[model samples]
Target chain A: MAHTIANKQKITARVRRIVGQLNGIERAIESEVSCSAVLQQVAAARGALGGLFEELLEDHLRQHVAGAHLSDADRQAGAEELLALIRRYAR
Target chain B: MAHTIANKQKITARVRRIVGQLNGIERAIESEVSCSAVLQQVAAARGALGGLFEELLEDHLRQHVAGAHLSDADRQAGAEELLALIRRYAR
Candidate 1:
């Protein structure tokens, strides 16, 4: 609920755009566009999608991490999990 | 709506855990734990957090990118955004 409050709109809009981008990529592959051009488009699409996740992740931290609903052990685990994810995917 | 359908519960649970992890990190700092031990905890926290994002990101791609609601351009942008976020944070 709290996470939704932070990003429902932006997430929705971004998701809509991502859907459109995927269609473009399909067309690009079908039309056999230049490899460079295709790759460029692919890169762009990934970046946009990643941004959406990043925003959501930040919201999770603000809401859950900074909140009072969890114990110290749980908070530590949560932070560890988050840090791991950032390292793995953001790399 | 669809995104929520895919991950509402898992996300909520993970957030709760992340909250607890944060508190643990704070305690570790206050207690003056060894630097290496602290770093280890920090690393663990980052990884866990990153995994949560990675899972959510995958869900986003599955729901929005793979669905029939978007155009080619939007999907490409989504993919690019995802890739960039992965590279940036995973690093």
Candidate 2:
């Protein structure tokens, strides 16, 4: 339904790396890494996650909701779908 | 490189739908849609965006970061990548 079929591998790889980063943070905490350095690492991870978000958002905007292919009814459904998702996301 | 290359079309579609949803919001505002109705629609759109984010995050986790293919060095780089993204997201 989404791009998951085509890009599952790539996405998984990024996430796994995030996992490692989390591990790295654990190690940093154990080693008593400086607050600034640790914070930097945390920030980096957050930024990376954002990148993933941006990529997906961009894709969604360009193809499904406003793409040339969709009919008016489909478009309304799309909006409804998003509204549904937002409810879950907020939870 | 993220999964954009492989799933650009699918991702784009989702984004386009989100745009439509935004348009709907504008229309509702112009019509003076009820507060509850407008708020619900707004919430829906927000939730939809979150769906896009979740999809990307899931992929990042499954394919790129934690996948079996990457080396430790690559994994670390992935975390660094996320960290970089987080900084931008916060800004």
Candidate 3:
């Protein structure tokens, strides 16, 4: 959808930060950082990625699957489409 | 982390909805939903999965990578852990 297409840059920026963090973690591992410390960073990166995921889902709901302007038939169709995606991703 | 462990139910609910959406999409395909309509649902599903990813990332960041109570050494270690996760996910 246009919303995602338009917001690609925004999403990329966030993704880049996560990437940077990842690189840092690799260095820490190489240097033999403490286990607890390393685990903490891992958790942070996980959260950041999750945030990005949530953003995409919300956009999908708003713009594609749950478009406010779609007719009932269109909406039903959209629901089915989203359902398929969920099945694919969940597995 | 404890936070993610705590919020598992909340996250699962959202996930279930997305799954339901996916099932619908499969049915649509079985019945030969139009390409345009199917495509729209596909976009929606993509967005939903992305959202789920984001949610996990956020939890990781807040409870693990960027924990408020960590020491500098511990925090550094956490960063490394998060970085590893990012690299893994990105690839």
Instruction: Supply every candidate's count of residue pairs whose N, Cα or C atoms clash at under 3 angstroms.
Output: 74, 51, 38
Question: What tens-digit string does per-residue lDDT give for candidate 2 at A1-91?
Answer: 3222124346446545654654565565456554334445555654554555445444444554677988787666656655554454345
| Model 3 agreement with the true structure over A2-70: per-residue lDDT tens digits | 223225446546545665665665565556554444445555655564565556556656766677787
Compare the candidates by DockQ and give the number of the best one.
3
TM-score for each predicted model, relative to the true structure:
0.43, 0.45, 0.45
Q: Over the stretch B1-91, how does candidate 2's per-residue lDDT look in tens digits?
A: 3332224446556655655665665565455553334445545655565565556545555555677988887677666655554454355
The sequence of per-residue lDDT tens digits that candidate 3 reaches over residues B1-80 is 22223254464465456555545555554555543444455456546655555565666567666878877876676566
Give the Å error, residue A46, model 1: 1.1
Error of 2 at B89 (Å): 7.7
Question: In candidate 1, what are the lDDT values of residues A1-91, reduced to their tens digit?
Answer: 2234466776788899999998998999999999899899999899888777777665554444433454545544545555566556556
- List runs of model 2 lying over 4 Å from the truth: A1-90, B1-5, B80-91
Best-fitting candidate, measured by TM-score?
Answer: 2
DockQ of 2: 0.03
Which residue segments of model 3 deviate by more than 4 Å?
A1-91, B1-4, B71-74
lDDT of residue B50 for candidate 3: 57
- DockQ metric for all predictions: 0.02, 0.03, 0.04
The candidates, ranked best first by lDDT, are 1, 3, 2
